[model samples]
Target: MSTMTRTPELHPAANLPTRVSLADTLSQTMTMAWRAMLKMRRNFEQFFDVTLQPLLFTAMFAVIFGGAVSGDVSSYLPILIPGLIAQTVMTACVATGVQLREDMDKGVFDRFRVLPISRIAPLAGPMVADTLRYAIAATLTFATGIAMGYRPGGGVVGLTGAIVLAVFTGWSLAWVFTWFGTVGKSAQIVQGYSLMVMFPLTFLSNAFVPASTLPDWLQTFVKLNPVSHVVSAVRSLANEGTITAEVGWSVLALAIVVAIFAPLSVRSFKRKI
Candidate 1:
């Protein structure tokens, strides 16, 4: 009898090229994001940490500044509300990083690694969900402001633009936080590091007060801070009823942040995984 040798059939996935298209990768990424949103829907209480604290801050600041600075609730409402909205949304970005760290510590990311998904999906997904959190905080802040007699000078369209800008900024900033989540030792460490960086960025800017009121050295830094541009952008839309160069620059800066950090975060995530 003649010996017969047969070649093994190649599986389609095995025969296919290893590389994936950018569109395919992004689609996978967005699917992961949708799953994260669904998780948020199921675990609504997790959001209270973000929503309640912002509401309290809005209330407290409105009360304190209304008497001390603006001399009336209505007067301070316009100024304090936008500031609170920006701060709350910005702070909410930290949750993206911390939660990622938590998930990693819990081995959720490791499970994802074994699946046939884009490496960038996990990071992108959580970031997208966090954007929703930012939106919730922004809406609540604006509603609270309205209740306190604040009005958006730019009307519905302007106000909508301002909210969209704030949400985009928050989403863009999540990339930096993703890097932290990938590299930080623990969720607590990530939280601490993010807070240390964010507090100064938010507080030192024109979020709470005019840059001119600061000392010269501080004023320089405040003007240079990206958050200053964002705060000015939102305030102009919500309070001033005008779209200026500052608003344009703020949006540009946010896009730059997303471009720069999103890639870095992906690289870091892949390395870690």
Candidate 2:
């Protein structure tokens, strides 16, 4: 008789290295972005949210609150349109975290974890696709305003710049939500936190009303709010056709937000696995 010994089996995954090259990182980002775009195309309801919500809100605000707030729809168009754009675009970013959370819950990221792609690809890729939603929301907002007899003094080029600014702000803000999405236990909780933060920043600022109308203490805060600076910058660009310090400050603040939250988000995602 002869004695026999058996060796333990090695898992397939154990053989795959996690690191990827710089060339692979860029390719992975593009590939992941395309996947996100394809998924959005297949999901028609998302397209509806991106398009219809802004149009309806613009009309509703012009109809219901226009007269109360600014004495008439026509009179209110200038301030109201920019305010609506800012509100819609910023709130649009909240969806990023919600969708990110939903994807995480569904184990989409677990699949990514096994891939030899950069960790950033799974995060930044969907964000690249989400920019389309931001564009749709912003473009529809201006179109709605135009259809309702509103005109931007900034002309086509200036309005274009305003849209660019709105998209930039939306993208930068999405990074913060990305952090929340990676660490959040659920989509609802992430959205809840986003709302708790955004509602005050959007409403308490000069978005819907004149800062002068707010009480002294509240007005002080509104004037200081970075959201207010962004709004003022957009208004200056679209309503007045001027470049101002507000744009500079908005860019600076947005850069600071990304600088702080982006690394934290990447680190969290790395450790969670």
Candidate 3:
């Protein structure tokens, strides 16, 4: 004889919460951003890239190549500072991917998936929090330059514009890295690939030397490099104190990057989970 049996539910559909509203989405994202900031404050060590690296690299590059590049550190400061700002901000963005991967690997984001929050918030909130990294890296680069007697002809207003632009550009690029973080197999792989992309973009551009100094073919690449445009914009604002066409080009590039990567990262994150 067969006995009738009652079985527990295969899924807890009844327990699922309703979709969150837009305001709730915004609120959750901000809360997650605050959470990320709190984690950063507690870990303090995570700030080394935004702080110590900028200071050390700024001095090291100025001392090592200043003489050869511009004939003296004082002369080089103008060229070096703006380029360093672009470079440092980009490097600091690598953390976005690394930390995202770390979270994904450790199952931290698993908890996020269960929450009745916007899917993108857990991904984007940390990115919003990463603006602090951009701010710190850029400010330290400029402060290091000023300490080394690199007085920007641009003065306060110009310096402020350049810093704002750098922060925006860095934040935009970080979206691309965030996409990488979502798709990557692990944190190390993401960072390795990110470094591979970053080093070429930073070093092959006009950041370290005048484009004309490079071979003709390489000069063409440097001229076309978006980073070159960013550096040029910063240099114009910081050194010449002018907001030129270069600034427009840089901003356009940043907008394009954000428009492309923000959606891609969100989609990739949803796929992963």
Candidate 4:
């Protein structure tokens, strides 16, 4: 007599949870953030933009353009410092997308897909780790300014507020880059496109020069430029020690940016991985 052997079929879904709880999502995101920190630590060159650029640009811009733009280095500190803070932080935000595209290309994010975690965790983790970079860049920028004899009238409290706002802005803006990373064909493409978007936003604004100095048409654009509002808010916080209408506009712009790009990044990231 021959006995027929039966094999039970297994469904992969049986082993996976239908949905990740909020607590689990948070825990998993933190774990992924730790992983990103380790990667950043191994590649110390990642700190160059945040560390070296602040030192070099702050000093170089203050010396070269200082006299030409504001009459002297001392006179330019108030304008240059806050502008540099915004520029440097936005530059840091570009790296978020480039690195993400590189990771995706190297199949790192593919590995993340197998884990039973929230889809957004891997995306959010890198941004969370990037907050440190933003903080370092903002701090070094202020330090370099002070070293050049720039005294912020805002004192410690206002300085603290400015730093916090810059970090938040960088993190929020990073989502735009994150979305690009998910959709870009390659890392270089992501970087090139990100710079294209960033340059106009930074340079066309009131970052390096006064909007009043620009032509009437350009001044109109500068007033409309969101980066100009950010720079103005930062200056108010660091140089004037008072909240201005620019601060409210900046916060509103940041909220709208995050609301739009964050979900788009998550959706695209989910599809890609």
The candidate scoring highest on lDDT is: 4
Q: Which of the predicted structures, 1 or 3, would earn the higher TM-score when compared with the native? A: 1
Looking at candidate 4, the ten consecutive residues that score lowest on lDDT are 108-117
Instruction: Give the distance in Å from residue 73's predicted Cα in candidate 2 to where it truly belongs.
Output: 1.2
TM-scores, all candidates, are 0.93, 0.90, 0.92, 0.95
> What is the C-alpha lDDT profile of model 1 across 93-205, one tens digit per residue?
88889989998888888876656677787888778777788888888888878877788888888788888988988898888887888889899999999999899998998
Q: Which of the predicted structures, 2 or 3, would earn the higher TM-score when compared with the native?
A: 3
Identify the candidate with maximal TM-score.
4
In order of lDDT, best first, we have 4, 3, 2, 1
Of the candidates numbered 1 and 4, which has the greater TM-score value? Answer: 4
Output the TM-score of candidate 4: 0.95
Q: Listing every candidate in turn, what is its Cα RMSD in Å to the true structure after a full C-alpha superposition?
A: 1.7, 3.1, 3.6, 1.8
Evaluated against the true structure, the overall lDDT of model 4 is 0.93
What's the CA RMSD of model 2 in angstroms?
A: 3.1
Residue 37 lDDT in candidate 2: 95
Candidate 3 TM-score over all chains jointly: 0.92
